[model samples]
Target: MTELDKKINQHFGGKVVRKDLTKLVKGNAIVPTYVLEYLLGQYCATDDEETIYQGVETVKNIISKHFVHRDEAQMIKSTVREKGTHRIIDKIAVKLNDRKDQYEASFANLGLNKIPIGDSVIKEHKKLLSSGVWCILSLAYYPSDEKDASPWIIENIKPIQVSNVDIDEYKDIRKKFSKEEWIDLLMQSIGLNPKEFTLRSKLLQLTRLVPFVENNYNLIELGPKGTGKSHIYSEMSPHGILISGGEVSKAKLFVNNSSGEIGLVGYWDVVAYDEFAGKTKKSDRGLVDIMKNYMANKSFSRGTQVYGASASMVFVGNTDHSVPHMIKHSNLFDALPKDYYDTAFLDRMHAYVPGWEVQKLRNEMFSSDYGFIVDYLAEILKGLRKDDKTNEYAKYFKLSDSITTRDKTSIAKTFAGLLKVIYPHGELNEQEAKELLDFSIENRKRVKQQLQKMDETFEEVDFSYERISDGKRTVIETLEVLEYGVPATKKTLISDESSVKSEGKNVAEDVPFELEGGQKIIRDNQKGISYDMLLGAYLIGATDIKIIDPYVRLPYQLRNFMEFAKLVTEKKEPGVEVKLHLVTNNNEDYVENAKEAFEQMAYSLEALGILFSYEFDENIHDRSIIMNNDWKIILGRGLDIWQKTGAGTILTNMCKNNDCAKHVK
Candidate 1:
């Protein structure tokens, strides 16, 4: 292991794992990442070569022996029945069975529904259960039927985490990791590879759930299909639940008025609507109203009684337009259906995840490292529902005096959820507390800022805050306080007057620089030059390179970005890093597409590790592409240089993977 890897193992090994390994240990089981990692920790915590190998075998054997793969599930079941009992690997969560006087368990992804779970499961395995939270329940079941003898017994029930992440220590430990390490730690915590991510980009990846952890956090992400927008609510942790927008009934989601039964919002930490952007999709109007109220008030009224649920709401959908085109034409809200484009409903949202900002999903996106079985993580989140953390961090920090109750609530909820997830032990110091708080504020600010653009009635308020750090308090506002939102922030703090003067001196003047071999370079327009000319020979010459951009929704757009790298690798120097400085927005609609494009590029660039990385391009107005220590190509259009392909454009005329049009203008 590298020094960093060793540190990661020491800090988060038990609670997290490498993301690539998620698939191997994960089989159809939908449990939280932490839960899987918890189990991996017990069985695979060591970095020792032999131990790591043994642990991998043990985990695979455990999954094979117990986890239900539908095809072989019957065989395993038959073995259990033949043995009169069998241990199984599955995500099992429980609820109080009042009438039966026992906690009953539901097996997630194992093809089993609610079964009679014994209290002994909790009593005997409380620590392990809590650590994994989501467990693989081992039940010994004896069938009454003679002919159809199937094993109903589950065994080796444990949480699925590989790290010992104590919530109490999250804040303290958070400070130690640079933002990159922190996210990698989170990925590791959830079993993802940081190598697959950049520091700023990781924040965008995690920003999807910033709302879930924040209370009444209303966010919307609309993009093309397959961005995995619903993954977090549905599979990342058990705290959230996903309901198809088409299937959600008002009663099932909010409180059922007639029966007064609590609904999904009451049970899950976050509630997300899948396929939320289909304007033509059928949906009940009443559900929209109830959702509007809940998003705004954090409570919904059922009949005469008003009850509140702490679940955050996220809307994920596919968009028909690109961000630039959308902005140029109508607005971000234009992607939504007519009914959902309501000013009132949109007002309730806290942030708008630019689903277009996300790249298509890649195979590397799935974790091969151990993580929680999402179902189990869901249960643990449910368990934590009652323990609110809104005020828990107040001792260490305080909000700006100007902040309102609503703002406080938004921050508190997000802060609480994250605190719950990372620092259940509650040992956060000043900086750690502030980082989460700053993030929470930024999410709300994103929503509020766009609301102003759409609705004139909404007043623009500086939603900034103040926090005490190192015996001194610093107040930051606008978007800059929350990394990557730099372009959006109105204020600028410069270290030196001369540097500031120099940076601020030019609006039209071209800056001059020299690439290696004494090649003079100058860029005048806001327009970005093609990567082909910028690093044409150099990138191709390099052995490897990575481009990091947070947004690349359209497949063609992604290809444009990848073509930039291809240009580099095609150059004179044949063995060097060809990293593309990709910076874009975050949105959900393009998850699958982005993943696909990334993978294809990876395959095509296999001979040379040509990579496309991502980072938030909030200040990307002046488009440019840079090569490692070799060159920088400034452009007017960035990666979006292609003209509308309809006027006899080759890309639109013929869309194929290896088309020459893909090589770029």
Candidate 2:
């Protein structure tokens, strides 16, 4: 077992299971992951090989016998009728039969209805009244002679979730894992390989959990699709519900005035709206107004009654346009439905997760190692909802007075949620606190900055914080504003000065250059810079160039290296050879493929009188280009800095236009 596996097994013991085991036992089963994990948690939540093998067989047999498949529903029903009594797994929803003066149940895939259910079961599982719950039910087949009489009689029912979690034991075990270990554990639990993501990317993944832990937290993520924006809400937690954006209504989300019944917000810890961004999609203005009020005040009025709910709201959708295009031609909220595009509604959002920063979901990103059973972790987050640690950062840093109360509140809530996710022990040093604080400030600032482009009345505020230790102030800017050109705002002078200072560069006639102690900061989706502009001055008179970046194995990355080679060849003497050595990690699955591609490229480069060679170094993480001329340049995202585009498109060339690629520093 790996060290992580050993540590998880030691600390969590039977409460954890290997994440891959769920997929192994879940063959052709159309149930949600939580249901599969719940069954695995019961029988296979251990590291012992023999016991796990036995548990796997037992779980497989149970699923094959009981789990209902729509295609085999008739066969299963026939089996139940032949056996007289049988247990089955299906999504069962219950409703009050006002005419019969009793509660009735419906099996979603089994094509059965009006199965008499008792008041006790309805009271125990209230969720059945709304969307429904997956449950294991025992049924008896009683053939009736009467035409209207139903044959399937309910015997016993159990919801597919842990009955209870020992919160105290969970907290004690959490203390055993260090902060980094805990972060990795959470990432693995979410089915992501922690090693593949940077600290910022990992934090972005964890930020998706904020709504689960923070009450009434309002979050939105708008970017290209396939980033798993709604995955967590749909599969990871039983306490959260994911609904389609277009399907939601005032009656379903808030309260039904006719029935006087509360909606999803009153039941689930989180109510996430999927596909929330579509300009032409229709939406009710009344629902948007109620959502805005609830997002800000945590309460909404329905006729004479005022209802309050603690469920956090999350909106996840795909943006058709790139971040730069939206920023230049329209506001970031451009893709949102007209009613939801209101400035007041946007202002109520606590944080806008930069979905563009999150990498697309790749198969290699999934973990094969052990992680906390997601249901168990979900319970822990739910338990932590009552704890208020928003003021923890205040002990080490102070927000700028220019930040409004609403802005501070949003920042504080985001910071607190992240702290709880990463540091459940409530302990963090100054630097760690600063990292989270700055991240929180930047996310809120993204919302505020975009608000300025949409509404002229909103003032630009300095999103900076002061460290209490030495009273040092650090300015925070949205990654978009820094990388892209400054937004055309009335406060252009102040924005320009802050942008220059933030990059640690001296501005001379619109050209920015690094001063003695300054370093360039590149923002995602920013444009207008080329490889020649970035590295030309440093590469002058350099004969031998060495590039070290482990991720140069991908096709796009290798293409980027070749493009950089073009720059080198353009600067070199006609016949003089400039040796370029590449040091990158050998991706085990693609090593042979990468080597072949590199060899072909090397053969091509030989014709240009540029000697190119490559080697694999497993220990390399930092990306840099070191020249024999003593000029070393560091890269944040390495050479593959351009956004992915359609093949054969003009934008395929990185240097074709300044805006063709993402910002690189």
Candidate 3:
């Protein structure tokens, strides 16, 4: 096992199972992931290889013997009749039969209904009253001759979930893992491999869990298909239910006035609408109005009475156009039906997830390591719903007053949900708090930005915050704004001397820029930035330049190095040859190739009136560029800031050495 897997097992023993085990024992059994994992947690929640192997067989046997498959329902019923009683796993829902004054149960897969169940069982698991709950139970078959008697009986029913959890213990054990490790553990618990995602991408995945943990949190995600946007609501938790978008009505979702029975909102923690996007899809105006009210106020009225519910609403759908295309031609909500496209209805949404940023699922993205039995994680998240972290960021920063109360509430709920998911123990530093705060603002800002485009009445608000200690205001922008926004042409000089600095000032006169000495962090996947934008101004007046980067041996690394050299040549004087030296390292596999590439680069640059020299340094680790002008520029990712793109693409052109499309302000 990997060290992280071992550590996870060491701390969360008996509560975590190998994530891949769900698919192993789930052959032909159409069950939710929580149902399968609940069974796996019983026998396979161990890291030992032999125990896991035996447990897989044991779970498979149990599934084969008890779990009902619709194709074999008659055979299972025959077995139950012959044996007089049989145990099975199936989705069971209960409804009160007012005429008979008794509650009746329905087995979803067994195709049986109106079987009488005792009131005691209904009180024990009230969730069965609203929707079907996956349960393990025994059914007894009896031949009765009475006029209104039923032959099938439900006995000893148990919902497929952990009965209880000590939330304090969960919070206590959470302190053992660092924030990154804990995030990874949570990612694996959701059946995703964390190694395949960036920190930003990981946070995006975890944001899907906020609705499950926060009350009345309204979220929507529209993107390309196969990104697993609706998978969490369907597979990760029994507390949440995924329903077809077209299948919803006021009666099915809110309440049936005639029957006076509450709908899904009264029982489930979250109700997610799947396949919710299509411009041609028809929707009821009454249902949309009720949804807007419920999403904003957590209350809905079907009759004269007002009923409140805590269920969070989630909408996941597929977008027809690419992000840039939608941004250029229309707003992001263009795929929604005409009724749902209303600014008033969309304004109730707390956050809009950029589903386009999520990478499509690949085979290697599924986790095989140990993670929480999803039910256990679900229980913990449900327990955390009561704890509020709305004021958590106030300790470090204060938001702008221009933000509306609705926007603030949305940002707070998202921030609080993320905090509960990652730091249930309530321990956090300023940097961590800033990350969550910025992400929360960006999510809500995305919603508001689209609203502004759709409706001119909606005014733009400043989504910026100020630090309490230093009063440094930080502005937040969605990734799409940075990726697709207009190109920046000029850069403001930072030095007190506004006049030009000499050596190559005239060469870069058309593209004026400047730099100051400070550390800057660029987020991954952020595009339209080039090496020239960052180091060009700093390298303008230097006669001799030395770059110390230990990793310039790979093909991509060499490409990045050449790009930096090109930037230097662009910012050099017309006749003077600036001496450029590179101190990089080589390995056994690429040493010869590295030398050849460096020789070729030197020969090429010599003709451009720039003297290029390079040497190998095996032990040099830190990356920096030292110039003769007494300025040293440090690099965290060297010259490889630009992500690779297809040849001759717009991104490739915009991110080349001389392009200054996106600049750091």
> For residues 1-665, could you state the per-residue lDDT of candidate 1 as single tens digits?
55566676676444434445555576765544444544555666655668767776787677667666656666766676677666666555655556656555665555554465567766764432211235555567666575533435444465453233344354455556564454455555444555555332344566665554555667777777877677776666645667788888877787666656577777666778888886677777787898888888778887888898777788888888765565445566776777777777886776555565455667676444433333333444445555668886577666666666666776676667667665544666766676666556655655665566678897756455434443434433332112222132233322110111112212112122322221212111112335554345433334333343444667677777766666655663555545544566545676666666666666676567455445554554544444444333333234554422211101101112233243222
Q: Residues 1-665, candidate 3, lDDT per residue (tens digit)?
A: 77889999998899999998998999988899999999899999998889999999999999999999999999999999999999999999998898999999998999999999999998889999987999999999998999879989887899999967989999998889899899989999999988888778888999999998899999999999999999999999999999999999999899999889899999999999999999999999999999999999999998799999999999999998988788878999999988899999999999999999888999999998889999999999999999989889999989999999999999999999999999999999998898889889999999999999999999979888888988977777676765564233442222111111112212123234334343334455455456765567777778899988898888888998989888888998888799999998888999999999999999999998779999999999877777887677666556655434211111111121222233211
lDDT winner between 1 and 3, please give it.
3
lDDT of 2: 0.81
Q: Going through the candidates in order, what is the number of backbone clashes in each?
A: 132, 0, 0
Estimated TM-score for each candidate = 0.59, 0.80, 0.88
The TM-score measured for candidate 3 stands at: 0.88
Ranking according to lDDT, highest score first: 3, 2, 1
Name the top lDDT candidate: 3
lDDT of each: 0.55, 0.81, 0.85
How would you encode candidate 2's per-residue C-alpha lDDT over 1-665 as one tens digit per residue? 88989999998887788888888999998888888888898889988889889999998999999999999999989999999999999988777776878888988888788898878887888887766678998988999998778888898898877757787787677788877788889999988888777667788899999999899999999988899999999989888999999999899888888778688898899999999999899999989989888998999988999999999999999888887788778877888988898999999889999998888998888888998888888888998898898999999989999999999999999999998888877878887787788789888988998899899999979788777987877787766655554433222212211122333111111233431112344333344556775566566677998988888777777788888998998988888898989999986898998999899989988899789999999998877777776556666567766535211101111111122133222
Residue 184's lDDT in candidate 1? 52
User: Looking at candidate 3, what is the lDDT of residue 613?
Assistant: 94
Model 1 / residue 368 / CA error / Å: 8.1
